[model samples]
Target: MKATVYEGPRSVAVKEVPDARIERPTDVLVRITTTNICGSDLHMYEGRTDFEEGRIFGHENMGEVVAVGDGVDRVRVGDLVCLPFNISCGFCRNCEKGLTAFCLTTPDNPKMAGAAYGFADMGPYDGGQAELLRVPYGDHNCLVLPEEARERQSDYVMLSDIFPTGWHATQLACVQPGDTVVIYGAGPVGLMAALSATLKSASKIMVVDRHPDRLALAEEIGAIPIDDSKVSPVDQVNEQTDGLGADRGCECVGYQAHDPQGHEHPNLTLNNLVQSVKFTGTIGVVGVFIPQDPGSPDKLYKEGEIAFDYGLLWFKGQTIGNGQANIKAYNRQLCGLIQAGKAKPSWIVSHELPLDKAPEGYQHFDARDNGWTKVLMHPDGGSHN
Candidate 1:
């Protein structure tokens, strides 16, 4: 099997590794047909997140089930499926309560939110970036796709992560119908958040970013695009809102956000969000933040004390929702929307590359290349595009 293995800071390559096979009675083996290199994966590539070497590096996956173990009944061989990025045991304490991301069955680790595929500090489960992936607790993890999933692979593939994540951001932000919403970061996730905001019928959707390309896409979605490069994003939002700010805001940049000049500034986005949001508004933080940075020391992130404007947040009576998206909680509904032809998250994807080109894909994505919104990788070196 070939996979994109993380070597070190700013290093990744596609190489042959052992083929994935069923490992437990509840396991299933899936041939990797579609997988994505997400913004989250950038953490490991930049060495900002600690993960062991030789580990596979992809989690947003969709594929056909090639094999299944004895205990698997819900999914079988030849069935198309999209598994959640989080590897929850269904019966775990947290999973039973609908918190799959913090499943209690997660293997012990000093560093990790819980078990995850292809995520550093998340778990030991290998990712599906290769030709095949062995899924533990297959019956619980795999979401059998509709009949058209094969035809709409690219859109369904997004259901594995970003789409659901964007929906989660909207859900966390408490986006109400007729409400005004603002989101920071026009990256793929942020853009999807803006698109998802449309689904909730938010009256006004505003996205802040310095990139013309990203902001242009925001405008195409009928959302207000605020180019922070020209002026403070808060100022633009306030000017548009008549100083009332938005009813809800989303933080999609996480810790990797940069100022207008492209220098890293972890708190800049959130601070802008705080000022651009109404006094009682909620903010969803979906951007990844970490204690270490291979890029350099960012003032917002200390060993543990990330420089956050909690003082202002507290003063403003703002509610904050933070953490990873529990992908299972939302993938199904989002899938139905895609099936209905209402949402086309695939629009964010800029390239479809064969497995062999993963090295180049990683480089371009790492640099956030122009028009490189998303890159979908397939094991066989081809795709729907």
Candidate 2:
């Protein structure tokens, strides 16, 4: 098999790797068709985490199941599936309660918090960026896509991570009908939050970001654009929401947030999100924040210890809900929306390259190049190839 391997900071290569197979009773082997280069991967690409060299690095995956272990039941050979970024045992205590992200079954190594196909801090499983992947607990993790979806692999592939993650942000923020929702960061994930916000009947949807292209995508989804590069997002959102602030806010920027000067401004988005919403509003923070940053790993605990105005939050009586998205909880409904032609999240994809081009895709996405919003990669072989 051929796959992209992360060699070091800003270094990756397309090379031959071992094949994937059903290694456990609950496992399924997926012949990957399309996978995506996600923002989360940048944490490792930029050398901002304790990621090891030569590790596979893609998680947003969609493929066809070619084989399944004897214990697997929900899917069989030839099922076109969209694998959730999270790898969880369906019968775990957390899994039974819809908290798949915190699945107690850590990988055999026990150093990783949980297991994901190809992600930092998410265990030893190889990513689907390869020609094939060994999907653990495939029957529980793979969302079987409809036949019509096979034609739009790029769009449906977003289900693997950001699309569902952004939707998760909105849902966590308690976005309700007729509420004014403000989202910080108009990245692909932020744009999806804007898109999902519209679906919820928000009275006004405003997306903040310096990138005009991202804001343009937000506009296409009926969101008011806030160009933070030109003026303060706080000023714009304050004015747009009549000074009371938006009814709810979503923080999609996470710790990788950058200031105009290009330095990592970790708490800027959260501070803005806290200030952008109403007095009693809530914040849905789906963007990832590493508890320990490798760039300045000395800050370790400080990496997650964002210095924001909690006093203001207390005074305003606001609430916050933050963490990873339990993707399995929402993939089905989101897929149904896609199947009905009601949502086309694929509009966020800016590039679609062959799997061999993943190294280049990582470079473009890492540089945050304008108009380079999202990239989808298709491996060589199997169904949909």
lDDT (10s digit) by residue, model 2, range 184-246: 989889988998988788899999888878889899888999988788888899999789999
Which portions of model 2 show Cα errors greater than 4 Å?
Answer: 109-113, 297-303, 381-385
Quick one: RMSD of model 2? 1.9
Runs of candidate 1 with Cα error greater than 4 angstroms are 110-113, 291-295
Cα lDDT tens digits for candidate 1, 1-385: 8888888878887888888887788999999899999988887888777777788988999898988999988897999999899888889778988889887686567454468898877778898789999888899989999888887788999988888888888989999899999999888889899999999999999999877877888898899998888888888888888899999999998876788787877778888888889898899988887666655566436553466778888989999898888988998889899999999888777889888888888889888778888889888665753
| TM-score of candidate 1 against the unseen true structure | 0.97
All candidates' lDDT scores? 0.85, 0.85
Residue pairs with backbone atoms closer than 3 Å in model 1 (clashes)? 254-287, 300-307, 354-381
True-vs-predicted CA distance for residue 190, candidate 1, Å = 0.5
Worst 10 residues of 2 by lDDT: 294-303
